[model samples]
Target: MNFYKNNEMVPMTRRYPDLKDKVKKRDNKISIQLIRAWDVERDAEKVLKIFLQNIDKLSSYRYWELLRSVWIICGTVENAQFFSSLMKSNKPNRHYFSTPEEHEFLRSLPDQMDVYRACNSPQDGGISWTLDYDYACKYAKDFQKNMVLNNKINKSEVFAYINRNNESEILIL
Candidate 1:
């Protein structure tokens, strides 16, 4: 993880004497621009592997949330380019982003990122579903009913979905 220092960040362990060996105290700022003006530091998991490193502690259902959070953080064109630059140097690890088309589809629409986690649960749990494809389709159809129109979305063919406190809805184009 990286640390914020002197209005900039350096590798925590090597550069920040105060944060040495204090992994929990480290700030994982991937983008200085992304930091809010009120908050100079941000704990972006994408830039650092520490917070999500406790994979054993997470239930199987929460895996998708973790993956989605990572993708959302590091799946930008510049981030992809940076990762590619590392690759050219034969770096051991790399990250990738979706194509513009795929990314646009995602950001422009409402996303049910935790559908996988919601699979095979009761309605009271809010959006619980069977993992089977047929059941998933039915859930989608039912979920579609709760959406409201927004942007280019139409009620008939949804482009976005918003689940309001357990009740679901979809908006279509």
Candidate 2:
């Protein structure tokens, strides 16, 4: 029994070793261009175009980063609508927008402005699994309040969290 249990745990642990640690470290870094686009231009279309062009190249984690960046710039309501329309037009495979959690977060935002504020705030808790609606809303509100009191957005630290390793470099193209 001990041998079987140990073996079972090994594969699970090996599958994603130090993933959480990597994410925690990466969260603080943002690309200067990304910050400039959001802060200076504030052009949702330009940002969305970059995201759309490079959508296929993104890893799941990068996808969330793009979404969060969009939320930060466009805010929850507009970004949600933009994504909904994009999804309708593109019809990409399952890998692109795989999670129902993402869809729910977008669709339900109009009624949850406070949660949107929390989710977008740079100082708030970074993206986590929001599988449950009520929990997500409550968590976002708490995160927003905490961020409001303790932290402020820092633009220079922000790095574009996209995967440039892939052939499709959106900004370049």
Candidate 3:
């Protein structure tokens, strides 16, 4: 589900302003897959860099799906073993955050939303929110000042959002 599909389209005069302001409808359920963009030739850091560089290709619905999945994965009361399992590598041949660079990348995933944007401004701008990661940008401006994260607020007015965490948040993703 791409975000631009259902988004209110501008007139032919506008020529589609920016990809970030567009959004499509969301489904009750979402599917997510964790991708490790690395192989033996490329270390985890290199993989992560490429992955981050490609963040702007995702759509708004895909972004929502990704964030919701990240919320489910990171924001929970699961036990230590569960957390440990989370730490465990999803791969049989590689390690989770095996390299120091990989560890830093994972640690900074949430805050690096800006960096991701700066790194990948081309190839469209949807990927920033689509790929699975932390630090969601519910709004296009959350990376900047005037951030608005709660997409489902106030009859589509997102000044205030009721996030999946059930917490009332302000205008920042």
Which portions of model 2 show Cα errors greater than 4 Å?
Answer: 1-33, 76-79, 84-173
What lDDT tens digits, residue by residue, belong to model 3 across residues 14-82?
112133333322121122112332223424344334433433444433433343233333422233233
**Alpha-carbon RMSD, each predicted model:** 17.9, 16.7, 19.8
Ranking by lDDT: 2, 1, 3
TM-score for all predictions? 0.22, 0.30, 0.20
Relative to the true structure, how large is the alpha-carbon lDDT of every model? 0.31, 0.38, 0.29
* Predicted model with the maximum TM-score: 2
Residue 168, candidate 1: C-alpha displacement in angstroms: 18
What does the lDDT read for residue 149 in candidate 2?
A: 20
| Quality of model 3 by C-alpha lDDT | 0.29
lDDT string for model 2 (25-141, tens) is 443233334556666887766766666666554544555545545544454433455544443443323233223433333444343222222255453333222223444445456
TM-score of candidate 1 on Cα atoms, chains taken together: 0.22
For candidate 3, which ten residues in a row score worst on lDDT? 24-33
